[model samples]
Target chain A: MNLGGRHAVSTLNDIIEIPIDAEGDIVRARGTGRDICRTLGFAEINQVKVATAISELARNIHQYAGKGRITLKVLGAPRPGIEIVANDEGPGISDTKLVLSGTYRSRTGMGKGLLGARRLMDYFELVSAPGKGTHVTLRKFVR
Target chain B: MAAIANFEPAATRLARFAALRRALSQAESVDAIAEHTLAFVQTALGVRSAALYASTREDEDFALIASAGDADLPPSLDRTSPFIVELGASKGDLSKTRELGSMWGVDRAIPAWQGDNLVGVLFVTGELELEIVDELQFELERALTVSIVAMLREEELAVLAIQERELVGLLREVQERDALMRADLEKARDFQRQMLGAVPRVAGAEVAVTFEPLELVGGDLYAVAALDGLLRVFVADATGHGVRACLTTMFIKSEYEIVRSSAAAPSSLLAQLNDAIAKKYQSAEMLFSAVCADIDLATGATRLAFAGHPPACVVRAGAAAMIGGGGPLMGLRPRMRFELVELHLDTDDGLYLFTDGFVEARATSGEQFGDDRARDAIEAAHRAHADVGAALKSASEAFVGGAKASDDATVVSVRRVSPEEQAPPSLAPASAR
Candidate 1:
């Protein structure tokens, strides 16, 4: 499993809309994430990777981003995986490269959550503009 | 001088009587006895034919046993013979000309007696000899008495032997079937036990689970996995109880294994599961309710999804709150999507997941233990810092108070742990984490 976040492709087989509301709402998103991974035939270890990555991604939305919508869709053809996209209009990260590189840490919380999520997936991407908010796209393959 | 001259004839008559007695004693059954009696009567009386009538039981009417000259005797002596009337009035013996004899001329009706009881009657009916003296008739009656008694005894023993054989055969068949059923149940129970194994190791959470089935095989199932730093737990309960329910659990377990790889995406996983089950068991009434949750230990972020299952409870600082999402029950429909709820867990916070069997468990008075009771148990466990599994068990057991549980009960407690409580960073395996 690769945790690198990347940009989303236009291919889709199935799509799901999950709203991240209260702190507890992240649980449902992660559950749906695991269900998709399991259906894709990910091993037990890979399933955990997918679920943990989803939890971290969704948690980022709920915590730093206030509340956001997590859009899950299936990718087919070139690669088969469940693509997880968490976008928020919360205060955007000022240093996207530094945060992704794991060198930057926010005073309020450990900076490892996003980095940890990146390490858990096959592909990861982060798009953010200061004041505009942050959008993250993650993909993990069944193979 | 005249007495001595008749002595030779008397000895010859005595010899004949001995031969008749020997033949009657050696007869094996009623039919054999009948044949022997007819032959002896015919030879000694110098008659062309003789018939014997017998009663197998005292309450039954007499029927013809054997005939030498004719097979025309009526099935029952009472129907055509006045001999029964004459014999009934006199138990000793009777010889009379027939008032109304059928074709055979009536000669004598002599009672076949064993002690004072009459077992049968011998009828001598033919045209030839009217010359039988009183002494000759007395001898004939005594021989008839011995033969008739032997015949009845043999018939009774034969019937009893046949009845006993049939009864033993029936009992053996029942016992064999019972043994086969017992073996089959034991094998199924063993297979179910093997399907449930060790709990998954999650990074930042401590998971404790308790499962109790009402029967050797039950419908309760649970799965725990810590993959890529995320903790996922699932618990499900199929409908009904006992062996049928137990079999249904296997389907749930296998389907979950395939879909659990979806990891954090429980909605699609459940939808796929529903499709699989609906297709496989189209005609069956079997279905399951489930709750699936994924937790990110690092951030204490958790997402929960349910399919016709009870909501999970999150307990923090001794306070319990309900969290649930709704959807159609799994296996009921294809391509169904479930609602998802997201939650964050703080240190020392725990999520309590269970099947309805836990809340719906009944007390001796038939009162259900309900959701409130379950919350109370979790809260008590949180306050006491006790094992949640034990606390839930104790509370339900107390309420039940010796009443048997009507359904299988399962509980899964996933508690977020402090940094110190977690495994050392290096010791935390990198692959699964």
Candidate 2:
């Protein structure tokens, strides 16, 4: 997607390159998601849910990753959907199940946030290793 | 099998049933509902104790809203306690049980619901081998649900009331701020208007003044003061616009008026005004550029004092000359001295005093309509017309065409009149010319 002169591509074939430290990156990501969902003829409730999910994931990457990038593209698969891939080079997840179970301990008590995010989006995947890095991919279908 | 028949009074059971129904329906608040329902359950089902616990969505914390029967049980149980009951639990769910140490009792936890949404739980306990009254349990749950909904409704109302009060407070603050700003603006506009002196008609000179402020208040000022056989004309432009700039100009005007009365020389007036402004407005960092000229009406000679102000043009015999030497802006130094230059006026000569606003206006491309352009326009207007007012107005409009003015533009033109023009027509003989 091309957003305000900045390009963001989901895959190597359809890649969008945006400045790593661009201003209002979070707002731009969410706005682009909303605009794409609307243009793709998605329902209002589904659009809102997808936008909120993208915002939360993007914020997490920006805050924890120190510096990272995001890519978005329209996935032409079994269903018409939008896929968002956020990756960062930082201290990766130690336990994947605990993070997904919403039981991981933190200052905010790990309160059901991951579970809520899972519930909000249709397909959610998180791949992280302690030493390597973290990658999150989320997809929301129009149907 | 041998049959045994026993007779019991129908009135007793009827009276008990009527009392239970009355208690269930009369429950109003959450506590009242819980208390009445617990009492009914204890009486009808012969239970030892009953309690009601509510779960809040914000933190999933449970609080004991009502209790009945034995005081032996702990005053409260945490919302997370399995014995206290939770959503998706039934009476026969053994997996959700707590070890009760050889105490045989019928303990049932009923989930409280409001329109298919589970909101809380109700717990009832009875002695060992006690048969629970199914009809009584059903009635208790229904009554408790109604009461809890009422209490939640009241809570919602209270929250709405608080929000309404907060909104009203914010609205009042905005209104007060708006009113204060309006009054300040009115005051600023009044001060700007007072700073501008009325158009003066010299007995022997032709004069015209034009002042256009970009906003409700501006920083441009022009004053004409005639005292002690001297005609003092001044034009000042302060930095910026609106209330603060207008205030700076007002202070300058007041200080100049005060100094003009005591000082006969233009340089003395500038020095005194500069000292007063520098002392009074030092903290605000405000400064002004001004051109003050003292014209001797008797001798038709004017002494000019410039304080970083734009040069004034003197036009005589189809030639124009820039009058006065420039000095530092006022308010920079406490004891700054200014030099005065004198120019002799010829008949029909015009002195045009102005501010940078006339020359520094920007075109659409952000290019400045520089001083040279302004001078050309002035000369063109003069050649096209002889009226000084018309000429200046034409030149300003042509130079600032279709562009937003950046500051206030002011123009004051003074034309010297010949001696014969000043003399009364009846006293001058027709052959005198």
Candidate 3:
């Protein structure tokens, strides 16, 4: 998305893009997201939630897809907020519903991984197809 | 009128001057008072050299003490011509002008006195007119004594002050070192507390742990953690006491947290712990002795593993027996396998774990309290009280009574929950629990 312009720039809403790999490149992207939220005077509790959400999504990409990329940008003006987009071309989810279900579990038996990330953050969405891979996005606002 | 009857005023004055000069020459020793007298005579009479001599009466020798001369005699000038004649002269005797060059080199002699005895003499060996010498002798004697005494006192005080400063500096260094040691000890003590874990609250068990440190920092450690449907407990004693031992325990606890999530079996947990500890403490002389157990609240089944530790006692049905056969101590060897012993617990059965401080306590006669005595005390407490917490406390107190625990004393008690207590809705499913 073209979240660029003088008006967008003056609004103090910046865009940051990062490519992920096994070397943990997305950690830098997550840290940038937290810094952007903090600079916009977001609450510490909200900023931490956004940072953690970004980290979890980024880690999920590295773990499931082997490698991916993420984009974190501040959106809207006057009432500034954050948007995180993480996409990976890994083996597509065979059962998206089951993966998102609370009953589904990882080897650690921590079934609440995706559900927990959604609960802690303000906005969450997930889209995936069997052969096409997955796209996940999260949003948090300064207010 | 002068020719007929003349009284010479100049002659009378001259006589008095001669007598005073003679007295200076006969005076003995060159102490502060005598040194002052020589200085005064030199300044007032304008004599070039004035020296005071101290005499050895037994040897009839005189040694120079204070001198202002062309070449001062080395502090010992004895039985020479000038000194010998000067000593022979009695009080009030004076030597007339005599130039013996370097052999005697005396221009004049003045007697020095000590009470009525002729102690020594003062010699003036420079050109001075007789008139001025006669006039200045008395004033010189008075000033010399005062100056020498003051200079001597000043020298003594300077030496004393230097000594005092050195002592104060040494004391300050010791105090600074002591404060640093105390701060380090406090940090170690806080770390030890963190390693022991927060006091555990088991759903079906009453757990009471008391740690009595011999000092600010101690070597003993005990912890209880409820993780993954199992209650894990451990009590460890590191070799020696204080900072080094405390650090060993902390290292073990950190390693424990990492392994504890996956290892549900006691022997497996101990094996992992031993391998990690052996690698970390290979260079250290100290090692860890511990008993680790996993108790399932739902099944009342406990698996215990020991590594050269004092065995824990299980009190059930009015009888007590030690749990777990001992194994090699941790950190001693690599790849050492720990033996695991499993036991089924009846409701309300109690388990007691303690360090060697209890049984190893010595009496006045230097005999150990012994394991048998310790077992008897536990039995007595169990007979007196049904509650496991009370029994353990009473037993330890009675066993160590009046004798101080030479090492760190620690106690951990666990009691199995009855079926009724497990019936609560909050309890997890039997499989999960």
- Give the candidate number with the greatest TM-score: 1
Candidate 3 lDDT by residue in tens digits, B60-130: 35657577757456565566566455445533433242432234566765543444444545677766554
**Which of candidates 1 and 2 reaches a greater DockQ?**
2
What total of clashing residue pairs does each candidate reach?
Answer: 53, 3, 17
Local error of candidate 1 at B139, Å?
A: 18
- The full ranking of all candidates by lDDT, starting with the best, is 1, 2, 3
lDDT value, residue B276 of candidate 3: 80
TM-score (0 to 1) for chain B of model 2 = 0.59
Per-residue lDDT tens digits for candidate 1, residues B209-264, read: 77777877788888888787878788888998889888888888987898788644
Error of 1 at B275 (Å): 4.0
* Candidate 2 vs 3: which has more TM-score: 3
Clashing pairs in 2: A8-A16, A9-A15, A9-A16
Q: What C-alpha lDDT do the candidate models reach, one value each?
A: 0.71, 0.65, 0.64
List candidate 3 segments past 4 Å from native. Answer: A1-143, B1-32, B35-50, B53-104, B107-121, B124-165, B279-281, B284-286, B382-405, B417-433
Q: Relative to the unseen true structure, what is the C-alpha lDDT of residue B352 in candidate 3, on a scale of 0 to 100? A: 77
Per-residue CA lDDT of candidate 2, range B164-224, in tens? 5446967999999999998888776765665574665556565567676777788888888
